[model samples]
Target chain A: MSFDGLWPYIYIAIAGWLATDLWRWAGVVAGNRIDERSEVLNWVRAVATALVAAVIAKLIVFPTGTLEASPLWLRLGAVAFGGLCFFIGGRFRQIAGIAAAIAFLAAGLALLGV
Target chain B: MTAPPESQSQSHWFLLGMRGIFSLPAIILMLSFVGFAAFTAEAKVPVEQVMFMTGMVWALPAKVILVGSMLSGAHIATAFLAVTLSSVRMMPMVAALIPEIRDRRTPTWLLLIVSHFVAITAWVFAMEKVRDVPRGGRVAFFAGFGVTLTLTNIVLVGLVYGAVSEFPPIVSGCLFFLTPVYFLTSIWISARHRVIYWALGIGLALGTIFAVVAPEYDILLAGVVGGTAAWWGERALRRREAAR
Candidate 1:
């Protein structure tokens, strides 16, 4: 790709990395003194968790790539199925299983010509 | 430093490797990255560049945004906006992980470079396993795992890139589904804060509706509306609970 074309990616990578690295650096510097389970940290956890959730929700509800072309109902249903797998598998396994299940389900649906 | 009694009890390198290997989220992500790299290559991005990005930039969503935008002929500004928004989620993650690793001897600038590899899977494993390991070892362990993951992602991306022509559209579609599914599944199963949950639901609903009307600011609008709503709703609910 041309240098002009590559600028956005480079800028984004550096900026995004710096913005995020600030927190990790801040965490390391600040973490030395505070109790990890402090209310402030807990709130941080909650907010971070929520933002991720929001992003995920955005992707599911309004995807851009190949996912955008899949049937909305199918995508939603696969998510639900994945959620079920997550719950059944408990915290650790479920976290991984849910994504796999959705992928498998979506692939299966596509194979059936749906 | 005294071994945290917990970590001292579980010194299974093999087990840790296995756990890292078997983790479903990591596998799915690796697969998706492979698929993404493949798709990017098909669109004419060079493999060497993709590998460099994976190793150096090390941010998957941003990579996807960068590649996808180039392919779609979207403006640089638009691609940057989307990527910046997506990467905003990293703020909370860094906040969560930062305190866990802080100490007198550790270098802040050094950790900053390393934090690029601190993706969702790293966060998940770190959140779960870091508490058990020694503070000094936590970074080392995470670095090891992250390197392994990055390598895995590259190979997967390379393989998929080679076979991109053979993969049918639907199969490709299914590969993309892994991320949203992973996100939604993780959220439903793991999130516990009632207000945050409400905020996420509200944010998503608002974002979706707003996206239909105006795609550009949907993420910002959703975040503001959802975050504010969750904050206020949480306070109000807590007050009601106290009164009861």
Candidate 2:
């Protein structure tokens, strides 16, 4: 890549650093002053939890790349099957559940001949 | 239960922490990073730049967004905005986690440095394991775990980037699936509050609905609206219980 092409990486590094690290530094400073049970902390936790969920949902619902080629039913089915495996394996078997989902997706793809 | 004596040296505590993450947690994180390495290779990002991002950026989702947006011809500012918005979730995680491992005597500079290590994997592992370490040892423990994770990523990303050409697209795609699936499973496993469960379910539904109807801002909208709904629902339930 040329020098101009490299400019984008530098920009991404600086901009991405500011975007993410600002929160971490702010949290460290503010964490020193706040009690865990404070309402503000609770709200922050709520928002964070929801944001992570939203990210996961977006991945499943609006995935990019080859995963996006699968039908919606297949995608949703993989998640549901994974959830079921999670529960059936006594809820602590996370890797097992994920493996099951992967297996389901592979098998479904094969059966569909897609 | 009796508290463990807080007499361990910082190095000792750090070694213990390293040992703790040397197992399943580290394996999971390594696999995730390898997946990300494959992803960067597929995106045609340079190996050196990928390593730089892995070291500096650290957060997978933001890194993914940065690469995805930039590859799609997004302007630098637009890519930055997308990555930043996606990563706003880490703030609460850091806020909640630092308090658990910190004390009045903890150095502000140290706290600032360690905060960079407070990603989802480290945070979850630390929350579960830090309680067992003595008070003074907690920070060292987290630092060790965090540093190990980073080093592992650096090494694995290098290896995967070189070998990515040998893997089929389907194999690489399945590996990519591990990232989001792992996040989803971890959240479900770690969440102790019923309200958070409600938030996740509602968020998933709303995210899907919005992705179809308004794909551009689906995640942001789902997070704000679904989280607010879950918070309100939990508060109402708490009030009813108190009244009863």
The CA lDDT at B197 in model 1 is 70
Query: What are the runs in model 2 whose C-alpha is more than 4 Å off?
Result: A1-9, B1-9, B213-216
DockQ of each: 0.36, 0.58
Question: Best candidate, TM-score-wise?
Answer: 2
lDDT of 2 by residue, B151-173 (tens): 77887898779786566545655
Per-residue lDDT tens digits for candidate 2, residues A9-43, read 68667757667788788878777777766766655
- Could you say which candidate leads in DockQ? 2
Clashing pairs counted in every model: 5, 0
Chain B TM-scores per candidate, in order, are 0.77, 0.85
DockQ of 2: 0.58
**Poorest 10 consecutive residues of model 2 chain A by lDDT?**
A1-10
- Can you write out model 1's per-residue Cα lDDT over B1-244, one digit (the tens) per residue? 6877546533443246435755766877776786776667677877766765666546676677666765676665666566666566566677667777544465767566557667766776666666666775666566666667877777666666766756766666767767766655555545555765776677667767766886765655566556666767777788899999
